[model samples]
Target: MTVIVRDFRPEDADAVSRVRRAALPFEVTTPRSVLFHVESANPAGKYRLLIAEMDGEIVGTAQVGVAYESGTPGQSYANPQVHPGRRGQGAGGLLLRTAEEHLAAEGAVEVYAWVLDEPEFRAFAERRGYRPTRSAHFQRLDLAGGTLPELPARLPPGVELRTAADYTADPRPMFQADAEVTSDEPSDIGAELDDYEDWLAHTWNNPLLDLGLSTVVLVDGEVAAFTAAHTDGERRYWSGMTGTLRAHRGHGLAKLAKTDSLRRARAAGCTDAFTSNDAENGPMLAINKWFGYEVCATEVRHVRTFG
Candidate 1:
């Protein structure tokens, strides 16, 4: 009944995915994405996927990495996910300790992790010297039969809706829009998206990104708003990001992009749609609620500063 923590191997992708899906059912992930996380990691990230194996079975994992994209120094994250059925075992604690050690060695001064709002999970993190900071919610929309509002009959003059695939020739416009909107997103460790090649490789070319289902709003031929979609290629859809450029914020562009994307998803036979946002992001949360998305689960961000 001993649990051991080790580094993720090429062959352990499936096991890692299983643990993640079991622990965080609201998020969408595949083995390919799991492998991509490791292979396409930025050298500066110092990314390490730690796995906890017990008696020859992998039970948990921690995604540990330095927040290299952030302008701030010493920001890092390590999220541990253990299979729900295997939680009583010591897999989670071992994985956390291993992740912290790895992150600390990589020059991390403060490590952030998401702890489930449940008492046991919160207690687990608190006992390890982590303190609650901000919270986030995982919301789900029933793409098949839910109250996804129909696309507006008139999309406001000079505004056009297009799929991300339309930018196949050159995605710099989408990249520009994404960067500006993302720069405004709330986070303890903010990211700066300045590299075009990195965005093309890691985002536009990612296997999970559904180009056809992702809807973008263009106003006067400019990327005004967009919703990036991720799917399991069958029935599950996830809103990886939905954002509106600063200039277009008060114009209902966010809702327009999401409405069009949701209808597209339902038409594509996706049964469920998942999304998440920081608790303080009231505007996006309100739009999601308008689309009938219900908060399925909440997780609080926890951080520990190493002296």
Candidate 2:
């Protein structure tokens, strides 16, 4: 069977979502979210979604783009996913090659990808000159059956809780908070959130982002901590980001926002909760452990530099 790689079409949302779910079950994805990503991507990102078709059926897909928000140039990312049942058909390799070629044409000097921490997956990446840098764990919680901690009786003085929806008039504060926290995150490639308009178009307006379910903590009327939530509108939910501003590190506001969001998610009938954390983030990892979230899978960030 001949495998062909091509750009994703609007009608390929289902197939693309299916491939991603099969490849990375810990994350929640939907057809609408897939289309929204394609539609809202900034041109500076040079984003491209490609699918691998075998006999007119899409069996694999990849998202390739430059890290437009990064302070450094030539940093790009491409994550390719093949259906579990369709592995070994050369579709994954084709998708990866297509993605890399596209990024290279766009002047990307270094490309990064996430590979499952299994032996085979690591070998696949190593064979293509990608070297593993850091690892992260995908954790899951049984929100429906497990008991969650009760919200604190009273927040610390000068602290209050709110949601992203509360900032309907202006989201610049949230953007600034996100940018500050994101710059300090541990990762293989460094990134800085530089564009407010791009962040709004891609993250703030994402269909899966439940602003009402996302909790933010305010200390003295400043955005001090936040837990961003994303959902598939059914049984699955994800913590997009849980971060604390620099000045509020030890106050447990991050935990407060996360717990409040998780409680709201469970109350809304979300059965499963998922989050990813860098292996080195001890504080966040400990917090997740307290919530009964267990590590289900791991992925290593891998990078390849063009000669």
- Lowest-scoring 10 consecutive residues by lDDT in candidate 2? 187-196
What TM-score does candidate 1 get on C-alpha atoms? 0.98
Which lDDT tens digits does candidate 2 get at residues 74-190?
A: 999999999998988999999999999999999999999999999989999999999999999999999989989988897779999899999878999999999989888888677
TM-scores for the candidates: 0.98, 0.98
Clashing pairs in 2: none
lDDT of 1 by residue, 218-305 (tens): 9998999999999988799999999999988999998988888889888889999999999999999999998999999999999999
- What TM-score, to 2 decimals, does candidate 2 have? 0.98
As for model 2, its CA RMSD to the true structure in angstroms is 0.9
What value does the lDDT take at residue 40 in candidate 1? 92
Question: For each candidate, C-alpha RMSD in Å?
Answer: 0.9, 0.9
